[model samples]
Target: MHASVKMQFDAIANDYDRQRKQLIPCFDEFYGMAVSLVECEPSSKVLDLGSGTGLFAGLVMQKYPDIHLTLMDLSDSMLDGARARFSRTDRVQYIVGDYSEYAFSGQYDAVISSLSIHHLTHPDKQRLFHTVYRLLRSGGIFVNADQVQGHTPAADAYYRKQWLEAIHRSGLTQEAIDSSIERRKLDINATLSDQIGWLEAAGFTDVDCMYKYLDFAVFYGKKA
Candidate 1:
């Protein structure tokens, strides 16, 4: 992650959890679908990339109480929020580092990320997919709930228009909305089809997008 991007997230770390539902119109369904697609045993070891504030990992932990998780992110301030969230628990471990360059050790039964991977350039996203494939144990799954680009220019316009309308109606303060918009400048989203292709090329099976609402999507593949 770029230093500016990390700084942006660090600045918003305190307000991120409260603002997430408002920023994302389909917040419940988007995250619920991603959690549903994660199939693992109760004691499965899981890894989360770009795990800002541990929101997604918290959801996964709720579903599998015994699952051990390693959460990685680029900003210490964001990780501080995660530390607070899981303060009394030993099952969760927090690592402050860039997921793209981090040297992951040991195999994982499941890997998940939400609303973070889009910050990487398209080529980096493809390379990260390959790294995730290599890090997973056989039959393990990788699930990503993030944003995607529309296939056509008109479709892209519609996506942006709908997002703007939804956020305006979400009752957030104008200042908050402006900050969100500024942060979005770092996004480098890929098309859903292209992401699925990358996952398949990285040696995943049954690669498919499980859900989508405009630019928001939940996609995953199983290592085979």
Candidate 2:
């Protein structure tokens, strides 16, 4: 599963950024909410997990240019795209590794992820929330802008149906759509309630879903 994710993302690295707007039905509001919740000092250290193509990090940089941003992903090709997106600067660093298992060295002011994490199994996702809690400084925030399963089997099916309908009419090429569907085979989304419980169990405070549009949602919490 890990190797498959790496290979598939590497194959689409070059076009990942361009296709995001079409792939996500609520691209603007989704990202806008995520970035807005990333409140921290201007020069604080921020870590982005599964930071493919650095799209979310770039937006965060726009908001806080002096921030020390670390982008980690399983796919080096995706980080290559990130390297091109940002200028050569000491403020940005890229690492090619699995976010779920990496032994990160220090704490951060804020930890964020986008369109990733759903690829992990439910247990992995819960473990990751605990990891994020431990990695955060006091009062630090964690925000995840990713997909989730619906409350029930029928609702989950409906969410998938709606997403498919939206994406089909979203103007992406057939090849791109097909590739996305193939990549989605790796998704193991947890329900919103389960995720909130995981966050709370991980020692996060003020835990809440800041926004939700179908399966795409922005979850936010802060370390106390």
The window of 10 residues in a row where model 2 has the poorest summed lDDT is: 84-93
What residue runs in model 1 are displaced by over 4 Å at the alpha carbon?
none
Whole-model alpha-carbon lDDT for candidate 1:
0.94
Candidate 1 accuracy as TM-score: 0.98
lDDT of 2 by residue, 1-224 (tens): 78888999999999999999999989999999999999999999999999998999999999998999999999999999899888767788889999889998999999999988998988999999999999999999999999999998998889889888888999998999999999999888988999999999999999999999989999999999
lDDT, residue 220, model 1: 90
Clashes of each: 0, 0
RMSD of each: 0.8, 0.8
Error of 1 at 124 (Å): 0.5
